[model samples]
Target: MTRSIYSFFICIIFLTAYSCKDNPKHTDDIAESPEQQLKQRYSKLVTYPLDSTAFPRSVNLKTNNLKKVPSKDWTSGFFAGNLWQIYELTGDTAYKNKAKKWTAFIEKEKFNDRTHDMGFKVFNSFGKGLKIEDDQEYKDNILMSAKTLITRYNDTVGSIRSWDFNKKRWKFPVIIDNMMNLELLFEATKISGDSIFHNIAVKHANTTLKNHFRPNNSTWHVLDYDPENGDIRMRVTHQGINDDSSWARGQAWGIYGFTMAYRYTKDQRYLDQAKATAAFFLDHPHLPEDGIPYWDFDAPNIPDEPRDVSAGAIVASALTELYAYTDNEYYLNYSKKVIHTIKSSDYILDKDIEYPFILDHSSGDWSKRSEMDEPIVYGDYYFLETLLRLKDLK
Candidate 1:
C-alpha cells in the first residue's frame, strides 16, 4: 500500500511539472484567447537578459540569433513601445519599469533630423509612455521631435522628403510611409498650439492623397517630386515587387494615416480616402484568406510567397480604429479574424526560443532580401496595438 501511494505521488509530480511549463497563469491550455497567449509569451520574454546599449529588432534566421539595433536604427522604438503596451494590458509594474528603461534610450532621437522616422522612433516610444502617465519630459521630447520632423518637408513639393540618399536618381523623394509620420505633427500642434506643425501635416497629407495613390487607391512606395516646381518627376518603388505594384505595408500605412487624419480633422475627404484604400487592401485578389498579405500584392508567386505579418498587424490595428469611427462590423470582424489567425502557434514564436520577438514571418524588404520570413520588432509592436484596440473595442 505504501508503494502504491509513492507511485501515485510521483505521477502527480510529473503532471504538475508539465503544467508549470505553460506558466501558472494559463486560462485554457488548449483554447486560450490570443491576448492570454500573448501575455504568457511576454511573461517569458520579459525575463531575457538583454544589454541596454542596443534594442532588440529581429531574429536573423541564417544565424538563428537575436538582432539588436542602436538608437539610430528606424526600428529602435518598437521594442520599448511593445513593453509599454504590454504594461498597459497586463498592469504589470515590472513591464512598466522595463518600458521606461528602454524608452530612455530613445530620447536622443528627438534631435535626429537626418531621418524622416521621428514619429516612428520618438513618438512610438515617448509618445506611448506619455499615454500611460503624463510626463513633462515625454511631452517636451515629443514636441521637439515633431519640430525636427518638419525640417524634412518642402513647401514646393507639398510633402516631407523621405530619403536623402539616391539623390542622383531622384530630386525630392517622398514615400507613402511618410504619411504615418504626420501624427506627430498633429499631436505637437495640439500640445504646443503651433499652427506651423499642423499646416505642414495637412499639406503633406494632401500631397500624398493627391499623388501617392493610384486610381484604385493602391499607394506607390515612392514618389519623386521636382523640388522647384512641385511636379511629380517619377513614380517608383523601393520595396514593392516593382514600380507599378502595390506594396502591402505601404497600403497599410495609407489606411492608417488617412484614418488618423480623419480622426483629428473630421474631414470627409480623409475618411473617404481611408475607406477606399482600406477596400483596396481588403478586396485585393492576392490577399491571403487569413488577412495577412504577401510582401507585394502583385508578387508572381501567389500561394508560395512569404507573408508580411507586420502589415497584417498594422491593418488589424487600423481597422479597429476605423470600426470605432464608422461603427462598421466588417472592419471589426476582419480585425478579429486577423487576431485569431496570427495568435496561433504557427505565427507566435515558440516558448523555448530566446529571441524577444512575439510573432514570426514578417517580411520587411524582400527586394533587398532583408528580414525575410523572420520575427521583426514592428510586427510585435502593432500586434500589441491591435490587441489593445480590440480589447477596448469589445
Candidate 2:
C-alpha cells in the first residue's frame, strides 16, 4: 500500500510538471510580446474606476488632520499625477474633473511656504494636471509654485535647498529624490516663457550629474555641500542601510529624472546617465527573481526588510518612457518584464476586483517613521500610470 501511494504521488508530480511546461501562459510565452500583452492588460485595468470621487481629488486623503508631514503632500500629489495620466488615457471627463479638484486643493495649500517637495507636490498635482486640461487657473497656480521652487534654489550652492531648518549648517543641497521634483522647473520654463526656471533646473541637474552619481551609476541619496564655499562635504543616504549603500527608490528616481532631462534638453549625456543608472538598478543582485526591487539594494543585512513596489512601478513607468524616447526594444522589453513580474507576484492585490492594488511589500521608509511595508497610494498610482503608458505606446 505504501509503495502504491508513493508511486501515485510521483505520477501527480510528473503530470503537474508536464502541465506547467505545456502551459501557453508560461512566463516566457506571455513576455515574448510584452508590449501587446501590456496594452490588453491596461485596457482591462483602466476600464474600472479606481475612485469615483471629484476630479484630481483623492480617496487617499480621507485621513484626519495629517498636518506637518511630507507624506501627506507626496501622497496627494502622487494621486493627482496618476489621475491626470488616467484622464489622458481614457479621455474621460470624470478623471479630468477630479484632477482639477485635486490641483485646486494643492494650490490652496500655499506654495510659498513649502520646502523641498514643492516641485513634486505642485508639479505632479497642479502642473501636470493643467497641462492635460489647459485650465488657466491651474496654469497660474503652477507658475506660483515655480516661483516658490526658485526660492529654494541657492545661487551660492548651484543647487536647490532641500530643507530650510538645516539651512545654515548644510549647503549644496542635492538629493537623488530631488531629481523627480525638477520637472516643476522644467515645466515652468515652458509654460511661463521664463528661462530662469530652465537655468536653475539645468544647474541643479549639472550639480547632481557631477556630484551625486557614482562611477557604477548607483547614486547617493544626499550629497551635503559647504554652504560657505559650495564644496562637497559628504555623500550620505537618508533612507538607505548606510551612506555607501544603494537605495532602490533613489536609483529609480535617477533613471526617471535623467531620462526626463534628456527629453527636455536632447542631451546625450543625460541619456547616457539614465541608461547607466538603469543598468545598475536592473542588474542589482538583490533584485528578486520576479524583477521587483527591495526597499534598498543593501537591505539584505536587515532582517525582513520590505521591498518598495513604488520604486519598481516608477522604474517600469520610466522605462516605458525611455523606450518611447529611444525606440529601444530592450527598454520596452524590460518594462514589460517588470510589469508582468509585479502582476504575477504574490504582492499584487487583485483579490479586490473592484479596487485592485498593484504590487505589494511597498515601504514608505522602513528605517524611519512611515507606513513601512504597506500598500502606498503612490505605488498604486504609478503602476496604473505604467499600464496606461503601455496601452498608449505605439
Candidate 3:
C-alpha cells in the first residue's frame, strides 16, 4: 500500500512536469527572447535582393493592362529605397552598391512629368537612396525628381497636382498614400533651400486634413479636384468598394503618413488625425482576436474575405511610431499586443523558412487582382520593417 501511494504521487508529478514543459505560458518555445522572436520573423526577409534581376526592374504596365500604370522610371528608385533599408539593417555595402546602380537606372529614365506617386515610387526611393549613399549623381537625380514634383504644384490650389492623365476631368487628385512621400518634399526643401517643396507639402497635408479624412478618422483613398478652379469635385476610394467604404491598406497609409507629418512638422492637428485614425482602426468590431485587420473593413457580404496581415504589419509599424511620438504607455502596450498577436497568429508563416514569403493573407489586387490571397513582395517588406522596428524598441 505504501509503494502504491508513492508510485501514484510520482506519476502525478511526472505528468505535471510534462504538461508545464509542453504548454508553456509563452506562445512559441523557440522564441524565448525578443531578439530570437525578431530573427524568427525577419531573418528570411534579409535574403531577398531588391535588384532588377531578382524582381522586375519596372512596373509591367503592358502586361497588367491597367488604365493607369506606374512608370518604369520609379522601379529602380523603388529598389534603391529597399536597398537603403537593407543597408541600414545589415550594414552591407553590396546593398549600397545595388542602390547606386538602381539610382543610375532611375536617372537614365528620368521623366519631367509630375505625378501623384512621385513621392512613393520615386522620392522615397532615390531621395532616401541619396541620404543613405551620399552619391552626387543620386543627389542630382533626386533633385530632378523633386523639381518635377514641385513644378506640379499649383499656386492657385495650394496643392500639387496628383494625376494628369485625366487632363480635362480630374485636377488635383491627391491621395492618403502621398502622405508617406512628403518626406521627399521636405528633404528637398532642406537640401535645396527651396521653400516651394515645403510649402507644397504643407498645403497638400492641410487639404488632406480638411477634405480627405472622414469624421471617423478613416480616409478616402483618392481626393479629386479641379486644378484650374481649385474646387473639390469628387471624393473616391481607389482600393475600397466605393467612396464611402474603408480599405485596410488605405487606413494603414493614413496612420503612418499622418504620424510622419506630425514628426516632420510637429503639428498638433496631424497628431490628432493620426490618433483618431488609429483609434478607429483598432476599434473596428471585425478586427480578429489577433488584432489583424481584414483587407477591406467594408469588403461586402462575403462568407470569408481575406485578412491582410501585411496591412496589420504596416499598422503595427505605424503604431510603434505613434507610441514613440506620444510616449503614451497605452499606445506602447497596445503596440506590444499587436506585435504579440502577429507573432502568434498563423498569418505569419514562421515555420516555412524555405519559402520566400513571410506573412500570408496578402491581397495584391482587389479589382482584377491576381494574387488575391497570396504572398506579395510589399507584404514581406512591411513585415520585415515591423520586426526591425521592434528590434529598435528593444
Candidate 4:
C-alpha cells in the first residue's frame, strides 16, 4: 500500500508540472506593450513582396496564400498607404522606400476615370505621399485624379455613379461608399482654391444624407437616383446581407465620412449626422462585446457570423477624430477599446509567421463568397491609421 501511494503522488507531481508548462502565468505572456506589439507586427512586413506588381488584397492565414491584385483594382492604393503609414509610425527608411515605389504605380490611375474609387485609390496613395513627403508631383496627381473623378458626376443625379456593372437592373446607382470619395474633392478645393470641387462634394453629401439613411439613421448601401430629376428611385444593398439590414462597413463609411465632412466644413448638421449614425452603431444590441463588428449587424447568424476587421478599424479611426472634435470621452474610450481588442491574439496575426498582412478575419463581399474570413490590405491600412491616430492622442 505504501508503494502504491508513492507512485500515485509521483504521477500527481508530473501532471502538475505539465499543467504549469501548458499555462503560463507570467504577465508578459498575458499582455504586450502597445509599442512593442506594433513594432513586432510591422517588422514582418519588410519582406512582403514589395515589388511593382504586388498589391496584396487578402491572405489565407492557415495556408499562407496571398491574393495579389493589379493596379487598376480599387484596393491597390491601400497597401501603398499602409507602407507610408508604417514609415510614419516607425521612421523606417525601408518602408519609406517601399512606399515611394508602390505609390508610383498608382500614378497611372490619375487618368482612369471609369470608377468612383478615385479617392480610395489616389487619395490613399498620393494623398498620403503628399502629407508625408510633400512631393509636388503627388499633389498634382491628387488634383488630377479629383478632376477625373468629378467627371462621373451627373448634374441631374446630384451624386457620382458607384458601379456600372448592374446597369440592366439599376439606373444611376449612388452608394453610401461614395461618401468616402468626397475627401479627395474637398482636399482639391483646399489645394487649388477651386470652389467647384467643394460644391460638388457638398451636393453629393447632402443628397446622400437626404436619401441614403433609413428612419433609424442606418444607411442603405446603395441608392438609385433618377438621372433626369435627381429624385430617389430606390434604395438597395449590394454587399450587405439584404436590402433592409445595416451593412457593417456601409454604416462605418457613413459615420467616418460625415465626421470628416464636419472636420473640413465645420458644419453642425454634419456633426449631428455623424453623432446619430455613431449612436446607431454603438447602441446596437448586436455589436460584439470585443468591439469588433460582424460583417453585417443584422446578419441572421449572430455568434457564428464572420467579423469584418476593416469596418472596425475604420470606425475606430473615425471615433478618434470624433472625440477630438466633440471632446467626448465615450468616443475616445470606445475607440481605445476597439484598438486594444484588435491587438488581442484572435485578431492580430502571429508574430513569427510571414503573414503579408496585419489584422485577420476581415469579410470582403461575403454574399459573393469571396475573401471571407481573410486578412485584407484595406484592413491593414486602416489598422495602421488607427494606431497612428492613437499614438498621436498619447
Predicted structure 4, TM vs. truth: 0.90
Arranged by TM-score with the best first, the candidates are 1, 4, 2, 3
Tens digit per residue, CA lDDT, model 1, 1-394: 1222222322232342222222323333425443444456687557755556678888986798777889988898888898999988767788888888888988888988899988898889988999998999999999999989988989988899998888889999998888888888999998899899999999999999888889998999999999999999899999998999988999999999999988888888999999999999999888888988998899898889999999999998998899988988888778866766764336877667768878888998866788988999999999889877766653
Candidate 3 lDDT (Cα, whole model)?
0.64
For 228-291, candidate 4 gives per-residue lDDT tens digits of: 8888878889899999999999999999999998888888989999999999998899998888
User: What are the Cα lDDT values of the candidates?
Assistant: 0.83, 0.68, 0.64, 0.82
**Predicted structure 3: clash tally:** 0
The candidate that wins on lDDT is: 1
- Cα RMSD to the true fold for all candidates: 7.5, 9.1, 9.3, 9.2
Model 2 spans > 4 angstroms off: 1-72, 166-172, 301-304, 351-359
- Candidate 3 TM-score versus the reference: 0.77
Prediction 1 TM-score vs. true: 0.90
Model 3 per-residue lDDT tens digits across residues 253-356: 89988888888789999999999998889888877767777788898753388877768777877887788878776555555565565545555554444444
The weakest ten consecutive residues by lDDT in model 4 span: 1-10
Residue-wise C-alpha lDDT for candidate 2, range 103-154, written one tens digit per residue? 5667754355556677677777776676676778777877787787888777
